[model samples]
Target: MSYLLTAPEMVATAATDLDGIAAALYAANAAAAGPTTGLLAAAEDEVSRAIATLFGAFGQEYQAVVTHAAEFHTEFTQALAAAANAYAQAEATTCSALNTFETQLQALLAPLLPNAGAGAINPPSITSIGAQVAFIMGGTGIPDPDPMYVTGAQTLFIQPRFPGFLSDALHTPEQFWPTTPNLGNLTFGRSVAEGVATLSNALTTQFSTLGNSAVVYGYSQSAVIATIEIRHLMAQVTPPSPSDLGFVLTGNPNNPNGGVLQRFTGLYVPVLDVLFNGATPPDSPYPTVIYTNQYDGTGNFPQYPLNLLADLNAVIGIVDGTHFYVGLPPDQVANAVHLPTSPGYTGNTDYFLGLTQKLPLTSLIRPIPYVGTPLAELVQPDLRVLVDLGYSDYGPGLSYADIPTPASFLSVPNPFAVSYYLAKGAAQGVQASLVNLGWLPPSYIPTGYPYAPSVAPGLNFFVGQPSVTGLSLLTGALGTAARDLGWIPPWWD
Candidate 1:
């Protein structure tokens, strides 16, 4: 039997390159159309007229052939793109089916198997009688000895770690460090290091002694600890399988695109005992889910600091308790948006963005009485557009929404889109404000979870509205403005 190996990513890239080639060809053909197809006799002579007519005919025939070729090229590109999508979907479906089958098979064989299942004929002598277990770790400020914090008794938010599997299962708390700040209780590094060590030992023991699978739940500071442990496990000669071990990190500062730690990777604050330890491993062997709240300063920092408005919004988010995921209702957490990963991403990691219903700007102003809410509603729509520019619309591990990212100085903003949003936002803001103030009836019934205004609007519009024209105009405008103000440098490009 013969087999064929296919890489969907390569196929997709080829299709993209072909499309570019077709576009260039089309542009070149159009430019030559008038000169090549329009016949103009050189001296009004018969021979000159004949020559021009013959060449014009040839040019027309060539154009007809080019059109057919362009059509075929477009169809081929579409087919290739579809093939890539199909292949990706097939792989995902297969993995899901296999996982489900494995779980079902384990459950069915539990009573008959000898020490092979949670309730097997000859089960291991352990406190918990389960094929899988969950470990919970608390964030900073929670005391180490507090049973509620340790055993996840009071952390109702993290109880739904793995919805179907681990919700009702045994939850073992791995609390071996001081959960307080460095200056107050223990040094931050020492505290996190201790948690990492404890969790590592616990996981190793569970795998060896109980011969069971396990999932860990980490929140805030403890999420950082989990990140460190994942790195350690990844470096091992034989790491744990995705099925055997999994991780759930909420408000993780080690998030690659937006985590505060990753935002200032090389920076360290001595007095605060905080080190920008960098991001969590994106290509870990264990199944991991990172949950980041939209504007949380710790988990989702701005990618472009030049946008001061975005920076202020993030700071407000921090003050508004956007980082606190411990008390959020289970349904709200479950409803978080699943972020998109890079194409052909084979790593065992998933990212989620928890959308903040109220704009951080609105939240900041909503403290005042009657006018506060209405006033904020009036300005939020337009202001959101400006803030959205501070982030990249499409990238690995990003949601197709108004999400934030770490600092990226090289990125340029689309000035036309900026202008469009400003106009659209102003209109929306006026309408919303009027509704809030009872001037106009509500256009849409408020669903308690109000949808924040997004640049992309939905998942289908992932590319948003950016164009070459917009970029060129923006660059030109910037240059012209700078020149007029006598601020243009000779080295400026």
Candidate 2:
């Protein structure tokens, strides 16, 4: 990615530019000292002119004048150094001024959308199969206008709200976790779980008339929340609904607990815990696909800890059931899962499988003897763990591109800074203007368990894949929904 600003080019360019200015100043100072050179050269003229009048007297005088010229030369050299110093100072000032201007320009022009907000809705009728989606935005702290504004069009109808947190927290290396326990006393890794729950509850009552296939997608923390909520949603349905696709947690929460915030929360949930209901609500057996960015942070699950490869090989078919390695078979996945706005395919099935079902990163060490024989026997030898691209603090890469206009101003860093306030005022101002609108039918809750995979090929198959697109996933999904509803798309994107 072009994200590695640490490369030498920028530094070299800045250094060379400053040097060029200094050299120019030195040349200019030398030119300014041209009068001294002329005077020295004129010695012959002065001697010639003086000899015609008072030759002997002028000889001593001219010699004395010539002798004093060395002092002038010394002064001239000093002036050259002074000129160079001044040039350097001027260059420094110019750089500082430019930096200040850029910072202010970004502040004034830096598009920042609100991270999260709520608005009253006038329900749209669902009239088609394509419109049956229940667009669920992913986890915490992503502002409006962010890239993830166009997620989940096939499932739920959505208008993304701002997440209200810094983009760096989602993508940076700083590790911070919430104080509360998530699900089964396990400390959830990121902030989106709460946001998802909040958003889901708000929509639950309003969306009862929407369809059954609740497609939740969000990158980073939002993904984690979507996964948890899908479990909850599945549990709420009797025998579960057929439409529940669960969560598409792009950038699988870093292995072990996943996500940068794992360590702070102090909750140690194993990767195996996700497959079963240990402490969370009605246990969810629904289908979920966790997507990971190949170039994600070192906390990236499959490559985590030094012994990752050996550990998986050693844990293969262990007794604790904690280390059973498996991969999602292609038959189980829908086009919706494979064909989102962006798709990443490794082409190596075994490698994809290893990453998809590999164990989560944890501090706990499992002994070889304690593993259950059945769990050990079930381990697949063909599993291919994802290729680790080394650790990175920059999460999955997504940054603002091309400067924007009202189209641009809206793209500023925090537009939703005003969303809460604007939503309160514009609530009524925007209602009467809509002309034509598209709608889908309300959902028919399907019978049977929603948690199980829709297609069961055999014990040889698993169908979930992990892909990471960072926080843009949620922002993009929500943005698409907001545009559909006729709101000015927030500028943060």
Candidate 3:
């Protein structure tokens, strides 16, 4: 027996290219029609007339042949395009049917299968090609009304919401993580541990199968589980090769630089049952991609916690729903910034930083009627500069492991740039405030010192150097007064 494999998208693209070629040929043939088919006699003589007549007949014959060829080309192109569409539709239908069948089968078999329930692992159906991909869903506590279980009689009622973005990204069948998704303080650790075990077992089983190869995708809490699994795999004496196994993680809490876990390493909150699990292994041999969204408190936390403003902003980001990647546009996710890895780093891990256009702080403030948006615009740029200082910018060939410590207290790597931004921010703030107060016309374009002029209108503002400097001094004075009055903690720095 033999099977055929086809990529409908590739076929469609090929058809489009062929259609363009056909169009070009048709135009060329049309242009040549008049000159070739209706040739004029060079001279009013027998010889010229005879020659012209002969060539004209040949031209007409050639044109007829071309017409037949063009007709065939059109038919072929149309058939190819139709075939592509049919294939695409068939694939979609097949995937849908398979998923539905799997769900039905699991429900039917539940009663007969012992210990087969929500936590039961579904073994991968190995293909002749020997490679497979699995998608592990993120954590959630919501109970599913339409429950699909691996076993009967035992109902866990713990089915998490499946993210559409993950489905779009991974065009494959999904494998549910066999763990409780509840984030309640008492259950969080146990749920995570179960997830880790389930994933590890599934991967191990897949690897043990003859000629089997696999790639696993993990999101959110499952990403943490994946990280632990990767560590476990690496620790094995005969670990699977990069070619055999790979990993993809999104919104990973174990992200090296910005992960909340890495930021507060070794810290344990008694009631919360949250332990900073430390960073994912950057030196792992298996292929991996870790994606972190900017200002997502779990994945992208501020390095300097002492910067209270930045800390507050990060918290607001999490609260404002930046942590969720549910409805993010695919293009935005695709266009994530590729973060540079450390020099001499032999690890197969790559990091991507998803940029957030609207500051999370702005989202937090933009709901207070008329004043909300304008006030957010007025203060965002200046506040952005201050908040940004909390993060250490890694240039080319730098490690993600440069974790910030309390010893680097209030460290300003470049005082000049800081001073310049402070002045620029102050200027922008003043201009934005004036605009909000109706002192400046809406059409009046203010200078965007720290950013581009093409940035959103209200986001750009400017003021004089003297005023900016005065404002900076005033801010400093206020800070000093707060500290002296014991309003600011002594050990905060």
Candidate 4:
């Protein structure tokens, strides 16, 4: 057999379309019937019908639940295959070019070997271990749909950033980063509270499997989880390794759950620490890089477009004016961890990774200003060191631009916004998402989590009807009272 030096491992979790069957049954008239006339037959009909109805409903729900998950998984598999092929072609061409260039260079100079010309050669054999991987997590809200697309784009984008060391153009993400199928336990779309444990477990699994250091990257909500988990999920636990690096790019929880008032009060950091099993994150050798976006004041002066919308919604009682807060600077905008949606004014992008300043019309006029998502400022010092990607982050090749924020109304069709972002992702010519919407577009941008309503009647609904959709605390907590703490679910087990 031809010895295989390296290959990308295609990872996949089967798309399970859970089986279901529906049946309608009725017994023949007991007096006239032969098979159906008996008591057993009557029982069978009733049981069959009941079971069919429930099972059918269960099947539909399961299908609905897995719909996004399965679609993204397929996209991921296909994208990886395409990326792997692209990488292979590029690598072959590059190697051939390098070989030709090296041959000519050797003729001009001396041969460069494992050792530089003159030292005494000893039995210094070099043993090699496999490559290290860097798994980047995406922002949240609608889960399951985002991760894979993020990964696909990430696979191509991450390669160029590490020119100093790794240069495996043909490598796949499984070989380069995350080495496995899970993004923490982010497979099923669940709220962050419930979602964190899965991510924690995923990290534990990767570290256990690799036994070598790796990079962990998290953006937005993913940043929060990665930051909290750095100490615990690191490869060597107590004895940290320099090889491990956790990049918590952006995810700033500026105000507790943003401006939305919760039914019950909960401390943001404290709750995190509790779930993480300590008052503070433990110190580790792995370093973390944090990239924050600055506040944009453009939406405030003439009045942000969202304010106008919020005003209209308030007049009709769609949203209460008391609870809805706007007109704050970008940093103060409680967007939790995402870029402010529908930025009315063109804010500055000085904080973006690789954007250049435009020259002014004249000396009197100032250079065009820039800004980024205000969430990047948040960082946790307890766990790891922070490397802030300031107004601009420059590597060897490309610049990360604060591509203009799209201004649109709620009425703006999603496809319109989607096409724009996708084009941007493609045009930027990088493996990054269009302004970090993750791999896939958000399924839905929830206005708020907990979604607690200050209205008492809403609170009554929450407490009285736990199963109510849209209005329940699980789905929507439209209440002023803390009848339900609405604690986030499925903390790391």
Candidate 5:
């Protein structure tokens, strides 16, 4: 079941939490500069690490400063949370003020939002493409009347979490399968297989009434499931019943181990053949788009440490030509008229660094909320105020079914995804889609940083002329995937 939190509820939770974090910061500063100082310094280091991680292969001097600022914010919040009533209340008041200030700031930019209009990519048919474990639902929302989109489509968008997200979301991004107790408990492939299995079973009966619907393998993660599951399903002779089959892989990963730590190359060959071997019509046979980001760390063959993975992601794909195509090239960087001719020469590192510096640290690090407060509010309540409504006891086995979907996840108010994609230099069509769908700023144009067009107001990340074209490939692949799924125009031979 999905639930929506009011704007006030969201603000209140954040105000309360920020109040706590502010107090923590003050305490950390005032308290003994020994242990507290150590913690503060560690946080600073962590922030630096996070910043460096964002750069991929490039690092900058400001990145350290940004890290320090983030750490300070974290320490402040932690200290504030631990403070007594006097400090906590004061901190809360300060947070309230900040919230008010933030509100006014947003009000100023409210006009930039897309004007309400009919959405894009409406599905025309419900082509059923059943899989054994789960039916993959693409991540990006598809508009109605789009051939691929079935009104109440049931699909899964599952993939391994990026490294940064591990620290950002799961708390331990480094812990691979069999490493961390909670995460490692289940086999990586097994979990995906299970999700597919359950989806297939439930969707079979659900789609019966929905019409001749199909399963869409969307996004890198969804594509991962589709590729792996297809390989597994192909092993069986009579692979269950199905309405219709299609694998609309957008920005699809050619290999299971293509992400961080894992780097298997040429793994997507079979899956590519399965979808686009000229066996099916232009739209049929599951269109797959191997999206490659020219600026993506993976674009540089030697940059990604693919050998680190124990078994998966063992092989490496070529970047320019020899590579097993994964994403788009650095079109964003290539368009830059004035390239950063810094001391070092070559590659997209210079461009990426330039862009990284543009995003301010203050925007990236979200303030921490109060202590003893609900976990939902303590971590970024503004994104979506999710006050725990008596749903905690279910410890380890917390599935999507256990919790309600927030308005933000289902209907994200902000276009963080679009902004990020734009920064990466996505295709004009995809950018247009984002703008048309009210996903991003309408006037936002893809240009080489420093010279290319204007930057969006209120964007925290600094934008130097990006030297990478990763965004181009990434957007192109995603666009291709969207087309395959009947969200955009079909791909031509």
Candidate 6:
């Protein structure tokens, strides 16, 4: 029972008289200049000269005004067309929803009715009414597709690294970020670098097969992998357009590469900004999230390779004459990166000041550069953009979770999870999916659902179990963690 509203019919037709008015005005002016055969005797002779000046000025202005009007008309027409298209799409979605609800309501009510007579809310008539919401079939023109397109709904979820004992030797840059599409070996499991490169290759294939763009999510070492994946895509001659990509980053190591963020807009939570002295650049469509929570002790672990000297970051900060991870006050939660978090160094004030308050003095071992650039600089720009986006009050929800004691930092995962949900919350598109799936709870859920488990379908972390020399271990724990966090598939022996 829908009816269309029509515009009021009482308006005057002034637009129709514009041409007639112009013609009359022109004729009147032209007639005034006719038959100037005899010159005026004295001062009156200047009338024709004055008329010529007035008409000349008016004609020049008139031409300019006409050009401006045409430009305005073009802009307005385009705007109108865009508005009409949006209206049509919205109307169709709403109508379909209403019809479905109506059909369901009728089915329920029909049974309750004691008298199912022809005049008593007939279901058949309602079905016919629903059928009337059909497409108009008379248009002949086909419009060109828009140049900037964000087509299809798909997500690319990247994962962070797990806690493990490793070394600076594991920073195999060549294997992690290969220049060619022919991905190198698969058995380089000593570092997250190899894992990331393998994952990148698989993701490219998966994205292509889906025929859709993706929303990449990453944290810690995995954050590095996420950017690398984008790099891989851009290297192609016909790279995927930026509109097709989106990011949901948290605790990333470096400032996100502007090359990608400028194109694909998304949420960036630099929960780990201290590593690169808070580098959040301003080149994103959305505001970045600056998160620092009490329980994230990982920041305290001097982002130098896991097995490299623990206090190496502090040494560099001291040598550089300023804190490398500068800009945080002692009271803040993110300042934990500046504070030493190991059990031995927890209560030691001297250790907090970058000295050997409770160590074997083993930090003298400084590792050589593998990837490129000084280590800190490499990690700086990647996460700096996150800081810059949040530099003003550190973006929305820009406060710390204040852990009661520094002792509970590593054990409690809640602080990190809090910021993780915040990142997802900022991505409205991802949030919509959660609302539809009913997985999001009022209370916090410890496990994160791997939106797409097979994102890196056949990624190999290390070639294989030591028993098998160079064979690809199709089933690996790291890849499983990358895919699904809510409930990971069991690891193979």
- State the C-alpha lDDT per candidate: 0.61, 0.30, 0.57, 0.28, 0.29, 0.27
The total of clashing pairs for model 5 equals 73
Tens digits of per-residue lDDT, candidate 1, 1-493, equal: 5533243444566678788988987888888888889979887889999999999999999988888888888888899889978865764564466445544554575454322211111111122344666676667654343454434422443344443334222222333234333435555665676677788888887788544777777777788889888988888987766667778787888787778776656444443456666678876767677888887877877766667888888888876878777666656677876666544555666777887767787786887899998888878766777676666543322232112233554444545345444554565566567778987555421221112643232111122212122333444455455456655322111
Best by TM-score: 1
lDDT tens readout by residue for model 6, 1-493: 5533111110111222333455555554455433232223344557777766666666656655655655565555455555545644654554455445434544565554222222111010111111111000000010111111101001111111111111111122222223212444322122234435555554465346434443343333444444455455556786544433444333333332111121112212121111111222212222122122211122222211222332343234233323111123324322222221122211101111122111112122224343222232223322222211211111011111111111100111123322332343233223323333454432211111111111111111111111111111222333344335423212110
Model 4: how far residue 36 lies from native, Å: 99
Clash numbers, per candidate: 1, 88, 2, 21, 73, 18
CA lDDT, candidate 3, residue 10: 51
Model 5 agreement with the true structure over 1-493: per-residue lDDT tens digits: 5522122222333446676665675565445333322322224577876654555323333444545765777666555444434444553564466445534554554454221121122122223433222233432121111323321122111121001000000011111145335544433333334445544554455446533334443343344445454544455575423334334343333321122212222111221221211110112223222222221222211112222321111121222222222222334323322211222112111111111211111122323343212222122212111111101111111111101111110111224322332333323334433443555553432233211222121222111112122432443454456456654311111
Candidate 6 achieves a global lDDT of 0.27
Q: What's the TM-score of each model vs. the native?
A: 0.58, 0.27, 0.54, 0.27, 0.25, 0.21
Superposition-based RMSD of candidate 4 using all C-alpha atoms, in angstroms: 28.7
TM-score of 6: 0.21
Which segments of model 4 are wrong by more than 4 Å? 1-128, 141-157, 160-190, 209-211, 234-240, 251-284, 296-493
On residues 1-493, what C-alpha lDDT tens digit does candidate 3 reach at each position?
5534354555676688779888887888899999998999999999999999999999999999988888888889999999989977885675466445444554575554322311111111222346453444443342221112111101110011111111112211122233332323324445556667667677678778756666666666667778778888888898877666666676777887777765655444433344555678877776677767787777877765667887888888776867665446657666776665544555677777777755787886789898887787677767777667666554331223322211123433344445545655666666666667787554332434332211111111111001122323444455555556655432122
Worst 10 residues of 6 by lDDT: 134-143
TM-score of 3: 0.54
Off by over 4 Å in 6: 1-190, 234-236, 255-493
Tell me the lDDT of model 3 at 484. 66
| Better candidate number, 4 or 5, judged by lDDT | 5
